[model samples]
Structures are given as C-alpha cells and as structure tokens.
Target: MKHKVILVVLDGLNDGVARHAMGHLQAYAAAGRAALYTLTCELPALSRPLYECILTGVAPIDSGIVHNNVSRLSHQRSVFHYAREAGLSTAAAAYHWVSELYNRSPFVISRDRHTEAPDFPIQYGHFYWNDHYPDSHLFADAEHLRVKHSPDFLLVHPMNIDDAGHKHGLDSAQYRNSARSADILLADYLQGWLDAGYQVLVTADHGMNNDRSHNGLLEEERQVPLFVLGDAFSFNPDVEPRQTELCGTVCALLGVAHDKPVCRDLLRPAV
Candidate 1:
C-alpha cells in the first residue's frame, strides 16, 4: 500500500501570483499534468475554512466550517480521517489548523506540546505567533514531520505571504515579494519531494486579486491552479485547457469522487 498525498495550500494566492511565480508551479505543470479550477472559498478568503475544505470532502455549507476558528473543531472526519480509517499513518504539521482541528490525525510536529492534553486544539495566536512574522516555524515542522512520521497523507502550509497579502493588498509589492520568497522555499521543498518519488498535489482554496479581495462570483477570484506531479497520479497532457474546472479536476487527480450538493457553482468535469 503505497498510498501517499500531500496538499500544499498557498493561502491568499491569486492566479496572477501563481503565473508570476511560474518558476515555482510551472515545472510541475509542464513536466507532468495539471489543472486549474474555479472554486469558491469561505468569506474573507481566509485560510482556515479553505484549508479545511481541502482536507474534508465537504464544502463550507456541509463541513460546518465557515469562519476562521469558528466550526473548524467539528471538521474531524477529514481526508486524514479517511486515511486513518483505512489504517494509514496520517499526519499533518506546520498549519495549526491541520495540527489541532484534526486532533485524531496520526502525527504532528507541532509546538502544541499539549497534544496529550485532553483540551488540546489548534490555537491561532500560538501557531502563527501573530503579527505576520517572516520566520517559518511551520516549514521546518513540515520537514520534521515528513522525516519522522513519513505519514501517508501530509499537509504543509506556509503563511507569511498570505499574512502579508492580508496586511498589504495582494498586489502590493510586499505581497508579491513575499510570494516569491514562498516560491523559493517551495521550489526547494517540492523538488526534494519529487526526488524522493512522492506524489505532490499543489493548489489553493480560491484565487485572489491584488486588492486582497475575492469576487467568489467571478472567475478571477475563483480560478486557482492545481499541479499534480510524480508517479502517483495521471491526467491528460492537455491539462492546461481545463484549468477553470478545478474542483472536479482535483477530485479526478486524487482518485476521489465529487458530489457537490450545494456549491452548484463549483467546478464540473471537463468535456
């Protein structure tokens, strides 16, 4: 059973930023198969719910996770849950959302030393340390978790760019610079993951514009990229033309079946 998946959710990342940082996502898209989808995210385009949706097969309406820190704790049966149910060593680190909300998740390289604490859960201030710091405690944790746990399902998140984009408009030089910085780090990590022959899934909750605003109703805000690399998945080489139908495309990439009950505006299978 060589089942393994890693989802990297680049928060507040827009199509423009993704294209600009093509050097980061391009290789994966070019050398392998990739798609883009127009998927709506939670209000304010925050990280919590979007990342949650990526984990659980449910939408905001179904997952009961609409706001940051609100109903996240209830999102217990995540993909990790499924993986663990299937008896795979599931693990997630870096993002407190991943470490805490999915407490039953198999492994975590978290600072949440109280993992053994009965009341332990994901805490934002402690996880992010607030104030948009440049340091990457999460990135380091991801590396540690991968090496130590070798989890079958891993989720890694880096937040400085999203933090900066939220503070300064997504189009601000500060945001793009932070985005590039993220790309640099991502390139190094992604390359190594591929070298190790691990299947990697790269995507975002939704697309954002420079003003750090999301239309949710428009393609500009909803359309985000998806890149699946390595030997674990398969997709058509003409994946580029199917970029906007992201939601279903991703399901296909990961071998999951899609069932959109409420978010009817979500992506559909490409014709």
Candidate 2:
C-alpha cells in the first residue's frame, strides 16, 4: 500500500553541529526506529533556491530561482502538483515562501494565509509569516491539517532554526538551542504520524555557517541531515540521496507518477 507522507523541512539546520543538539532524533536512529542520511544541497545554498530544488528536482541555476529574493511562482512542477494531479490530497503548514512557490506568488496574508482549493498545487495550506514563528506552533498547525483534511501528502516547514542562525550565527548557543527545541517538538508528533501510516521525511533546506549566512560552497552551508521514518525507507540504502531527489521520493512515497529524479535506492523495493 502507498502510505501518506509528511515532509518536515527544518530550515538552516547544520548536519554537523545539529547532530549533537538533536539528541531525540539521534536516539530514534540509535533505537532503529529511523535511518539517518546526509544530503548535500546544491550550489548557492540559500533557502528559496534549495526549497525549489528539493521540491522540483531542479537546481537553482537551471530553474532561475537562484536566490531567495526571486519571489515568484515556480515554473517547474512540484510534488504538490504531482500529488494533486494524481487525485491525492495535499497540505502544508509552512513558511509563506512555500505558499508563494506552490499556491500563489506574492502571497497576500488576508487572502492566502489560510487556503483550500482542490485545484491548487497545494490544496490546503496554513502559511505563517514570521521568521520567528515558533516551531511548536508550526507542528501544531500541521497536526490540525492532518486531523481536518487527512491530506495524502503534507509539508511542515519551520524557520526558527534558520532565524536563530541568522541572528546568532550557526555556532552560537541560540542556534544549538533552536535545534534542540525543534527536536523535542518533533518528538511530540512523529510517532503518532507514523502510527497513522504517514511516511515522514525530515530534512533541511540547507545548513548555516558561522558568518550567519549561507549561499556559499562551505561544507557547513551545504550539508544537511535527512531522517527517514515509517516503513517506506530502506535501512541499508543502496545509494546516497541528494536534495534534488526529494521531489520524486515524495511522489514515490505517495504512489504517484512524476518526471523528477528520485533516490530510488532509498526506498524499499516493495514500495
């Protein structure tokens, strides 16, 4: 059976430093409940470009969404589009940039903050406007969507880690604490989502650096972690996955047809 999927993108989370802070997620891996993989983000590791890359399997240069300020609708078809076209429900509790990418461009808070249109790529959305919008609140919003819509695919993207990184640098205590807090918050909903037959893929758009910035080639800026939960993933994955592989992986999880490149080895043969 094709399982429903929940993708949690923790913005600006560093693979190296965050591993030490995210003990709860580490424990889950240690206990054999999940598999951890490191994914290398594409060039110019900024959030918006990487977000589009992660969803459409197109690199920033190829898609022309090379920077965060490019604020326009995505031309490439995303997993949300693929899911909806395949007659599956899709929802997101994410940053407004997500809404801009999948639902509407230049998002208007009044008309676009809460949306439900079956024909839209993201059929249901609860988009937040603040960089400091609590991760706790974002997860709660995701849970609310799950309970209300039971969407076959859900995107939960939170920005607090990135916010902290931008304000205090990746090496600061605030950045570490933000990662720890997000891990604790995720622990609240993960098992329940898994029990409800949702395949969860938790990752980051990109990592952060000591200069309080990204969009560079530094290892600290390009490397992030992907945590695979539920039964869809292979503990012994045949090949490493990249950020661009996420779109097709998500479609594969939902049993939908898609043209994007996928990390086929990351999933079980039976899936």
Candidate 3:
C-alpha cells in the first residue's frame, strides 16, 4: 500500500519546552501516538544548516551550509528530489528561505510573493515582510494543496515557537505561550493526518538555548524533539537518533530510493 507522508517541522522545537509548556504534545506521547526521540542536529544548530542536513542527509561540513547567509544546497540529492524521481508529488509550505531552496518547484508554498508557478493553479500563501502571519495559514494552504493534488510528500514548517524564542528568551512566558500555541496547531494537524491514515512525522530543525539564541554547540541547542506517529516507526523511546537519519527514514516509509549510505532506517525490525 502506498502511504502519504506529512513531515511537520516546528522550528526550534526543543524537548525541554515541549515537556513543560506543550500539553497537547505530552498527551500525544502518553497516548502512544507519539514516539519521542532526542534528535541531535548538525553542528552550529543553525536553521539553514540543520534544514540542509535534514533534507540531504549530509553533515553541515559536507553540505557547506554552516551559516544562514549561504543560499541553496551544495548537494542536489534531497528528499524532495528523491520523491519527485519516484513519481510522487511533493509540496512544501515553509518560510521564504525554504521556498528559495526549492525555487520554482511548483510545490513550494511560502511567504515570498515573487515565487510563482504559472502552470499550476495552486494559490501559494504569501505574507508580508516584518509582519508575520499565523502558522494556521501555512498549514491550511498545505492541506488545501494536499487534498487537491494528493501529494505523496508534504513538508510543513511552522515558525511561531522559533520566532517567540528569538524575541523573548526561552525561559520567558512569551516563549511558553508560543509553544502552547504551536502545540495546539500541531495537534490539529496530527489529528487530520491520523484520521486520513497518513504517516505523520514531527521534528525540529534545531533547538534553542536559555538565551533563546542558537547556532552554538551546546547540548540544549543541538537536542531537538522528534515525534513519529505511524505504525511504520517502531522506535525505542530511549534511543536518540541523529537528524540526518530522517531523510532515509522518510524515504523508506514512502518506498522511495535514497542515496545516503550513512543514513540507516530507524523503523526496521521494530528496534
């Protein structure tokens, strides 16, 4: 049976904040819908580098995306490319930078007004600069495209928690509030996917420190929360996985081929 996969990336979603501030996430874990894992992200723990690692299954040093200012992936082989090669429709709803990475893919729904796909009728959501829109809009746009296009792979990046963490320290009440809000939105998305029988994978690009800044080598900055909600993943809750492994895991779940020899399938043999 072919399974549709939805990977939701809550940017800067850390274990500490999810355990304390996010009640919905805790409930999901308790109900067996979530398999919690501490995923060690790439060095520097920056968003772009971690994202490149997650998508390409390569290290930051090798991918050459150690900083946010760097544009585009040095390597061309990514989950998106693999999915497309397998004849599976791919769609991504993320920030402007993410859209830039998958520029003109016709499946990138982002806040950038300039990116367009004249061939497709999909109305990609666009938000203004300096004024952020709610994550619900992005999710809704993804859902619309999913229902209409029946995309085999869908990637959603929600930035509320990350933004809040950046503006206010991780210890601040504002950060907690943003986490709770993100948790609520995530719950809704998870329920829809579960009801539709789609494989759901939730993870973060990186984590934040107490000061709310990342791009460091601290444990707190490197450790991210990964929640897999599907029978395909029989992960051991105690076993922490590297973020790079996710690319292969997603490929295996979707029955797509990947070229990452170092990436092992975490779901095989029931751990």
lDDT of each: 0.55, 0.91, 0.71
Worst 10 residues of 2 by lDDT: 230-239
Q: Which stretches of candidate 3 lie over 4 Å from their true place?
A: 104-131, 261-265, 268-271
lDDT of 3 by residue, 1-271 (tens): 4567888888887777777777876787798767777777888788878777887788888887788888753454777777777777777677666654554332233435433342321123332223145777767767766676667787888787888888876777877788788888777767777778678888899877788699878877778888777766665665657787887778777787777643344474532
**12-48: candidate 2 lDDT, tens digit per residue:** 9999866788888888889888888888999889989
Alpha-carbon shift of residue 22 in model 2 (angstroms)? 1.3
Top candidate, metric lDDT: 2
For each candidate in turn, the TM-score is 0.73, 0.98, 0.87
- Who wins the TM-score comparison? 2
Q: Tens digits of per-residue lDDT for model 1 on 1-271?
A: 2435676777666766777764766755665444333344444455556666666555566556676656335543555445444455544544455564666343344545323232233211123335364436666666776776665556666667667766777658877787677777777677777666566766676665656666355555666656566554445443342222333333333344444222222223321
| Candidates in order: C-alpha RMSD to true structure | 6.0, 1.0, 3.6
Sort by lDDT, best first: 2, 3, 1
Query: Candidate 2 — which pairs collide?
Result: none
TM-score, ranked from best to worst: 2, 3, 1
